[model samples]
Target: MTVQPGRRLLLIGSGWGAESLSRQLREQTNPWQVTACSGRQANPTSGADLLLWLLQEAIEPNALDHELGLWRQQWPQTPLLLVLPAQHRYKRQWLLERSVEGLLDQPAADAIAEALEVLAAGGRVIELQPETTSQHQRRGQGLGHRLLCSGVDQIERELEQINAVLQLAPIHPLQRFVLEGRRRELRMAREVLHLLWGQEPIPQAQASAPAEPLQIVLANRKGLTVLHTVEERLAHAVASLDEAQPSPLLALEALLPDRRRQLFEALLLEFRLLVERLQADPTVASSLWSGQQPLLRERALQQLVGAYTQLPKEGALVHLGDALVSSSDLQQEDPELADLLPSLLALIEGRPLLIDGGLQAPDEPAALLHLQRLVSNWLIRNGELISRELLNNCSGWPELRRAVLLPDLLATRQLDQLRNRINSAERWHTLVERPLAIYESRRLLFDIQAGRVEPTMVCDLRDAELRQLSWWQQAFTLLLEARDALAPQVELLINRVGGLMVLLLTRVVGRAIGLVGRGVMQGLGQGLQNAPSSGDQRS
Candidate 1:
């Protein structure tokens, strides 16, 4: 049969299974140009629109990652649809992060057809829901099982290496998180290896029901059922641990055992108190605000205006520093803090403050040099309350809220108050650049997704780091503009100091990159943890 030209698919797999799939594709009313291959062989003669990677059930996590990487390199523009076993469903997010388009778990030809349709339309099919049926334990001594065993061996070696290093030198706090995360991956991989070999620890008796209704028990080992539950359920089940003998499986859980218990207790107590309080005053919520949602804008409109009103209007905003000689003066109880209430010394930071028109440098030249320092000290005293209010009130773009606006609000939310007191002062606008910032940030993210900007561009910089970089870049440019205003000697001095500052800032950028690298490593380990394998049998 001469199948009509249609969407080209490169189906990478082998055997009778591949033949059956190809036959199904040919039989479809909208036939596709299918090229099937054993992964060991070369790719198709022509470039494909899409890739269908049919990974075997028992493929090791590490091996799967390598194969995916190769496919991505080979077909950078082509979207990949992974046809995987039900056991490998846990890898969906890991695959998605690497730009895999769709996942069809234990797919029928119809499921494959549906997934392809979605892909053709530029939509994603993360995982096709399979019909509920009994899963029989697979039996085989296949290549995948061998690879699994090898992967487990590699993980075990890595664990030993980490343990040896830890014994010799105290690991940094950040490094410890990475180490423990790796340990979890090793244990999970070991479990999968045992399951593949039919050597998993057997449970004496199966429970009629999972102990926790919300929990999904994967395996029962040495009288302890390794289960998965949501964050909320984890909170209620702190005391449910069954005194199982110590093993490497619980290494991640070992950290903060005491702190976790204390936290659980505290939360439980707080909930009880809240319930009792609600019972006592059934009308408190109504009396508070009549259930008109405590939106950030409303809170900002009220408290934000009130807070800003306390800043001094007249001369010597700088001299307020001398009056705030003692830390206690900033506190409510101190007379000095009350007299110089919202310390002007604290809020002014060198970065241009947003107002009605555009960015404004401080009126006083001295204020420019120590703007950030002043703001930092003020926030040190009164920041917690301001932060709590803003956090509780806002929605959307949490990074923008926390990093940019929180400081903006801290510095200038009260500027309107200063304007009201003295008509000459310009009103500090709340969320002036916020709307624009949100749009630009989202646009940048979109560009990354569209492949215009590489993910690597922001991979090293967290949202805060990116925002800070943008701010510094603008600040440096603004300072350069002011260079012409100063005397030649002053301009030279400024140039030298500015260059030194830029060099120091580059160190921060390097640190952010290193932090991101560590985080990526931790995430890689985390993804490998809790993968459902043949060993994960439930009665």
Candidate 2:
């Protein structure tokens, strides 16, 4: 299919995807005669009516400027359209100075098509205009405001450079801290400038947008049934434990041997008081279950467990108890603890009783099961309250919705990992052993409970590196651009010269040689006609 003369378009580079922009353009209904080439291969002789520059790689402003200059010289009358990446930091004024007719950042097909139509009709288009009317008004208020705005812009640029370095390079932790501190200072300065200029403080944009709420699906009846059964067993165990422990002193006496009961009574009482304090508050139980309110939980747990264990202080095994109580005192006070220490530790870690090298005590298993049930019930009862607390902390409904629907948006592999951690005893034990793993699990669990969802965070290292430019780097870039900018012009000149040389060889030299050969043939013919035949001479 032949396109009209004006519809010819030369696509300079492949777009963001695997497919070339030319192919994508051809697929559209615009009937454009698309010619695709890499940046190195582009030349003036393409006879294209429009030039579309697709900049997928990170390019410095000076480099871009030089390239644009070369393109403009090559195709003086052709309209230039630039398609930049969404995160490109190129200035609008720079592009306008180069006479770019149209600009689109990470544009869709429809947007690209519209821009093309507009450019073809001698119109201009630029999508990224962040300057608002209010900002313009503020900028024009006075010289002081203008000066402050300039200072703010400089600080922002510095911050951008620092951030780019942090994202693109792996630096020492100390160096990273220094860089981050510098960024904070710059941010403070920017804020002060904004205040002085009477401009509204800019809201910090979230790194990742909140994920959309996932559609609710039918519940798995079999899974629910299993959960219900586990709940029933846990409830039964709790009731039994409650019956066994009519009072804290009596419970301690039952659990400890007679010889050591008096020696550890005071310590046991203190531990019991701490546990009772935490247990009495419904919020603590809910927080523990849902992994919310970490500060509250941490402080409360510290008094009983020496800032680590969830168990009462007195409940720690003799060897495990530290500075608060001597190991010798604990051992002398309770010899029976030697036999039950492993079981108590296992329960605290939330490990199953049936695992290899795990706890074998029937009472300890019952106690662990009862604790689990108690925490779960507390969470169930206060679920709405916790949800409300979580929602209240979010910026808006979108954030809350993202929190609630996070699990549904997780990839299959991520979902499988979560399931394994929950269902497999081995996985759970492994997770418990790793502090980082436990912290991550708690964070994820908190998000699930709060009903918040966010997209996965990512950084384009190339883009980041490209954005970080120093004075020397800019100078070096200009030198490189000078070399690159000369390449096409040199090639074009050589091509024209070569074409003329070929014409001289084919048209002028060949014709002259043909004429000489024709004259020789004519002279031979004339000589034969003038001379007598051999047969006639013999007669």
Candidate 3:
């Protein structure tokens, strides 16, 4: 049956009520068309917006399951309204599993019409009549209620445990924060449930989370490149040293083959030249080195290895020359050749020119070294404080603190892996302009450390929030101390100062002070008269 030219409604079942449902559906003012089919012949057809399954009588089990499964498979998007007997009310869970939209307790013509309209408008209706319960029914309802409360309480406990860990977590997790909020909401729900049932207060929350905070640091590109190139070489050298046993020269010789030596030497020459360029731009050089010269030297050495891996030949010098000196006149003059010749000559005989030029320094990668210092300091200061907050017995998670700082080192190690991920200039700018400036700042710093961009480029991306936050923390701490120190004496100090000023303003004090002041003024005038004038001295 067609009612209107808009949404289509499919009615399936063998029932006299199916005819009633169909007629009622036709009364909808919204455009709708209806199709009536028997439960035995219930098959999905095109463009059905809603399905009404009216079962006036129970069907055979195997056939009913098969037909429902078939409808589900075919018209999964269509909302289904089940109209069945009171006995079938137990089938509520079964119908829900099948994605039934509405369950009408009694198949009334008016109710079916309203349900269809509600389903059409994307609302669900489950209208079940309240009935007087026997002792068994009451027991069953109480069991369900207890089960629900148990599940909710368990979830709250779990969330509480997670929040305990998060309290000590070095990195702030949005997911954990959201879970904490949900736990509070669940607690409120349980309180409401208690109030509604007029029961005793809910049992105390017994969930206890262990003090095991997890931490992970994000790696940057330059640090990764350094790790891959220089760190690998150091690992090889160390391994070779261990194997060669008492023959350090043999290990050194084994590790530094002639081809690798040449590459190293060429790289040293480029580094020396690069240093000259950086020195000329002192501002850029100072920030890049960050006054940690040993770390800077290590970075340069790592970049040297990267340069060799990429270029691998002496001809790469041509590219380096072009990068440094673009003018034809300067190129013709071959100033690079003149400048690098001394470093090249020194390196030819295995006297690493870096020693002379101050580029080669034996040290840990700067990023990791810097991180170690930061972590160590944090442990000494905030570690105990956080430990107190996290657990009464335990001190702190020293391992987790190190892990938190590992991102700087990890980013350096993973530079090559993330080069393509955060390499766009436009992407960098977009991140800078984002409202979460502090997070974006860290992300961009990771990119720089990863070697996705020039270390020099790091100077351009500036967000003062993290720095400001640090300053604010210090200032706030000092302000709190000052307020506390002055808090008790503040009123007394003000009153005493006010009382002294008031006494000075009184008539008796003024008269006594005036007499003394007049005598002093008269003495000063007499002294001036006795003193020699400039004119008399000159004459």
Which candidate gets the maximum TM-score versus the true structure?
A: 1
Tens-digit lDDT string for candidate 2 (286-379): 3442343333222322232333422222344322113323211111111001122233233334344432333432222233333333333332
Query: lDDT: which is higher, 2 or 3?
Result: 2
Residue-pair clashes per prediction, in order, are 6, 7, 16
Q: Pick the candidate with the highest lDDT.
A: 2
Ranking by TM-score: 1, 2, 3
Report lDDT (CA) for all predictions.
0.45, 0.47, 0.44
Deviation in Å, model 2, residue 385 alpha carbon = 54
Q: What is the RMSD of candidate 1? A: 29.3
Please list the residue runs of candidate 2 whose C-alpha ends up more than 4 Å from where it truly belongs after superposition.
Answer: 15-20, 40-45, 129-539
Q: Give candidate 1's TM-score.
A: 0.28
lDDT of 1 at 280: 54
lDDT of 1 at 376: 23
Write down the worst ten-residue block by lDDT for model 3.
Answer: 446-455
For residues 1-539, what per-residue lDDT tens digits would candidate 3 score against the true structure? 44554468878865566676666666656545778887534434456888888776676656667877788777877777777665542443344334456767665677777677766766556554433223343234565566656656676687678678767757567877786787787778777766665453332122211111111111222322222333333223323322111211111112223322332343334444554555455445545433333333334333423443332123333332222122112111200011222332332222333432254311212333222222222211221121112121111222222222223323333432333332353254333332234433332221011101111112222344435445544465456567888987998899999998888777668888999999999999999999999999999
Give the Å shift of residue 69 in candidate 1: 0.7
